[model samples]
Target: KEIKDIVPFSLLTLHNEKYNKLQQSGMSQGKMKALLHNQAIGHLLKKIAPNVPEAILIDQFAKEEVYYSYLNKESVVQTENVYFSTKAEGIHLAVAAASILARYAFIKHFDNLSKAAGFKITKGAGAKVDEAAARLIHEKGLECLPAFVKLHFANTEKAKRLVASKYRK
Candidate 1:
C-alpha cells in the first residue's frame, strides 16, 4: 500500500499547515525548522530499516563541502569559505540523512509559499526572493505584503503607483 493511502489525509494536512506557518514566521524560525526536520527524518530512517551502508555515508559527509560548492552556480565564494570536518570520521549516516531531510523541508516550505501567495516562487536566496516579492505585490495587495520584502524595491514603488492610479480613476 502507498504511504499516502495508509497515512490519514487530515494528519498530512495538519502537518503541512504547521510547516507553512513556521516557515513564514521568520528566517531564523525557518532555519530552525529545517534543522529539526532533518534530524527527525534522519532518526526515523535509522529506526525503520538501515539499508544505507557505512561506506556511502562516510563518502557523502567527507564530500559534503564539495557538494555544497557545486551547488553555488554563480560564484566560487562558498568553495573558499565553507569547510566540513566530521569528528566521527567513519560514516556519517545520520548527518547525510539530515542533509537530505533539510533540503526536502526547504523545498516543501518554498512550494507552500508559492501556493499560498498564488504564484511560483523561484528557488534560491536572492533573485528568486525578489521575484517572489514582486509577484506577490502584483497578485496580492500591498497591505498583505510580508515584512521580509524591501518596501524600497523599484517594483514595490511601481506597484504602489499603479494601485494609487487605479483608485484615482
Candidate 2:
C-alpha cells in the first residue's frame, strides 16, 4: 500500500548478463552497482521531469552522500531541486513510497533470478553467501556461475578459489 499510491514511477532492472559485460570493463563491483542505481534514479527523474509542475522532489537514499556525476550530470534536468536529507523517508511521504517500490522491485527480481539459477540465491556478502556460491559452482559448472550472479561481486573471486581448491579433491 505504501507504493500503490505513488503513481508515475519508473524502474530499471539489471540482469547478470549486463553486469558480466560491465565487469569486463574492470570496474569495481561497488562502483558498478552504484552506477547502475544512479542511472536508474536519473531515468526516473527524467521520466517525471516533464510532468513536474515547477520542481520535482526526490528522496535521497540513506547511503547516498556524494552525488554521482558520471551519470549525465550536464543534462537539463537539474539536481538543485533534489533533496538529500538523511532518512528522508521518515520525514517525507514521497521518500517512504519510493523506498517501498524499490524494495518490491528488488524482491521480485531476486525471486526471478533464484528460479533461473535453480537454487535459492541468498542476498548479501556473508559467509553463507560465499558457501552458496561455492556450492553453486560445484553443482553447476565453473562457467555457469555468471548466469546466476553478478560476476563483478568480490565474492566471485573467493567462490572461484573455493571451486578451484575443491577440484583437487
Candidate 3:
C-alpha cells in the first residue's frame, strides 16, 4: 500500500522509458546509479529525526540491501560499506527510513508480480527462481509474468526449458 501510494503511474512510465532506452542503446549502466539512489534515499531518511538510533539505521540499510539483492540480483555494495560507519554515528535516521522503505518497496513489487502471475512466486531472483518462473509462464501463458521482472535475466532461458520439458512430459 505504501509503495502503491508513493510510486505513481508516471514513475512506472518513466522507468519503462528508461528501460527501453537502455535496451536499445545497449547501455545497461544503471547499476551504480541505482546504488547511489538507494544510498541517498537512505541518508535522507536517516536525517529526518535526531532521536532515531544509529543501530536502527544500520539495520535498515542492511535489510534494504539484502532485499534488493534477493529480488533483483543487484548488489547493494554501497549499503554494505556504509552500514557499520553509519551505525556508529547514531545520526542517520533518514538513511534508516530509506532502507526500510526500499525493503517495503521490494516486497510490494514481488507481491504484485505474484498476483499478476496468479501464483505465489518466491522472492529469490536466482537461476532456480527463473526456472520456476519460466514454468509458470509456460503453464499459465507468457501474459502471466509481471512487467517489473527483468526478462534479460539468464534464468529466463532456464525457465523456458523447464516449460518445454513440462509440456513434453
Ranking by lDDT: 2, 3, 1
**TM-score pick, better of 1 and 2:** 2
Model 2 score (lDDT): 0.68
Q: List CA RMSD, all candidates.
A: 11.4, 3.7, 9.1
Give Cα-based local distance difference scores for all models. Answer: 0.45, 0.68, 0.52
Error of model 2, residue 46, in angstroms:
6.9
Off by over 4 Å in 2: 1-6, 26-50, 57-68, 72-76, 165-169
Specify the highest-lDDT model's number. 2
Question: Model 2, poorest ten-residue lDDT window?
Answer: 69-78
lDDT score at residue 152, model 2, on the 0-100 scale: 66
Stretches of candidate 1 exceeding 4 Å from the true structure: 1-91, 147-169
* Pairs with steric clashes in candidate 2: none
- lDDT score for residue 159 of model 1: 47
How far does residue 43 in candidate 2 sit from its true spot (Å)?
5.4
Q: Model 1 Cα RMSD, Å? A: 11.4
